[model samples]
Target: MARPDKVAAVDEIAEKFRGSSASVVTEYRGLTMSQLTTLRRSLGEGASYRIAKNTLVKRAAENAGLDGLEELLVGPTAITFITGEPVDAAKALRDFAKANQALVIKGGFMDGRTLTVAEVNQLADLESREVLLSKLAGAMKGTMAKAAGLFAAPASQVARLAQALADKRAEEGGAAPAGADADATDATEAPASADASEAPASAES
Candidate 1:
C-alpha cells in the first residue's frame, strides 16, 4: 500500500473506532486466506474484520479515546468492530474460533468498557438483539390478552345472575296466595243443606 493510502486507511479506522459500539481483538496468526474469508462472511453486515498494523491501531485507539486498548494490539492481531450489537460479533468470533483454532480471541471492548476473555465468551452466549425484541413483543401481547379476559369476567357473572333469577321465577309458577292465611282459626265454616248430600263413596270406601 502507498504511504498516502495507508494514512487514509488509518484515518478511516480511527473514525470507525470512534463511532462503533464495540470491538474485539483477535490473533489470526496461522489462519489461511480462505479461513479469513469464511470468518468475514460469517460476520455479515453487522460486524467487520480487518488486519491493520499495530502502530496504526494504537493511533486509532488513542484518537478514539480508547487508549487502554493499546496493550491488546500485539502479534498478527486483527480486529472485529461490531457496529451493531456487541453480542452478535462475539458469538460469530466464538463460532469461528471453534472451527479455525488459529483465529484466537484475545479480548474486547463493549460500551466503552474493556472486557476480559471470559466476559467476551459470556457475551457470545447471549441472544441476538432481534430475538430479545421478539420475546418482549410476545410478552406484551400476552399481557394484553390477559387484560381483555379480565375485563369480560364481570359481564359473564351478571348474565349468570339474571339466568338464575329467571329460573327461580319459572319454578314458582305465580302461585303466591293473595292474603290467604292457612293458620287462621277465626274463619267461619260453611254447612250443607238437606238437598246437598255426599254421593256414595266409590268402591264402598
Candidate 2:
C-alpha cells in the first residue's frame, strides 16, 4: 500500500475500533467469496466485517487506544467490529464456523478484555439481546414492584439494553425520549451506535 493509502486505511480502521462495542478477529483463509458474503450478512446489520492487513490493524488498534489484540492479528486476518449486541454477532460467527471449518474463530475483544476462542463461543451460547430483552420485559411488564429490584441488580448491561429498547419503542410510537442518541437509528432490532453508520468494508487479503 502507498503511504497515503496506508495512513487513510489506518485512520478509518482506528475510527471503527474506537466506535465499536466489541471486535472479533478471525482467519478466513480458505473460505470462498460466496461464503464470506453469507457470513457478513449473517452478522446482522450492526456488524462490519473487514479484511485488513495485520500491520495496519495493529497501528489502528494502537491509534484507537485499544490493546491486547495484536497477538491475534496473524495469518489472513479479518475482523468483525460489532456495534450492536455482541451475543447475536458471536452466535452468527460461531454457527457459521461450525458449518465451515475454514473460518477460524481465533479470539476476540469484549467489555474491555481479551477473550479466548472458547470464551467467544461461550458468548455465542448466551441468549441474544432481543431474546433477553423480550424475556425480561415479559417478566417485568406491568409488575411495577419488580422494576426497582430489576434495576438494583448487578446486570447493568442488560438493564441499559432493555431501557434503550424501551425508549426506542416509545420514540417510534410518537413519544420520543428526553434525550436519545440521534445515531441510534437502527432499523433492525439491535441497537446501533454512531459507529454503526459506517458501511461494512471489503479489502483484499
What pairs collide in candidate 1? none
Global fold similarity of model 2 (TM-score) = 0.68
Instruction: List the lowest-lDDT window of 10 residues for candidate 1.
Output: 186-195
Tell me which residue pairs clash in candidate 2. none
147, model 1: CA deviation in Å?
A: 1.4
Per-residue error (Å), model 1, residue 42:
0.4
The sequence of per-residue lDDT tens digits that candidate 1 reaches over residues 120-165 is 9999999988999999999999999999899889989999999999
Estimate the TM-score of every prediction. Answer: 0.74, 0.68
lDDT of 2 by residue, 1-205 (tens): 4699999999999999889999999999999999999999999999999999999999998998887998899999999999998999999999999999999999998877889999999999999878989999887875866776676775887888999999898778774442244435443435454345443433322
The TM-score leader among the candidates is: 1
Instruction: Return the lDDT, model 1, position 26.
Output: 95
lDDT of 2: 0.89
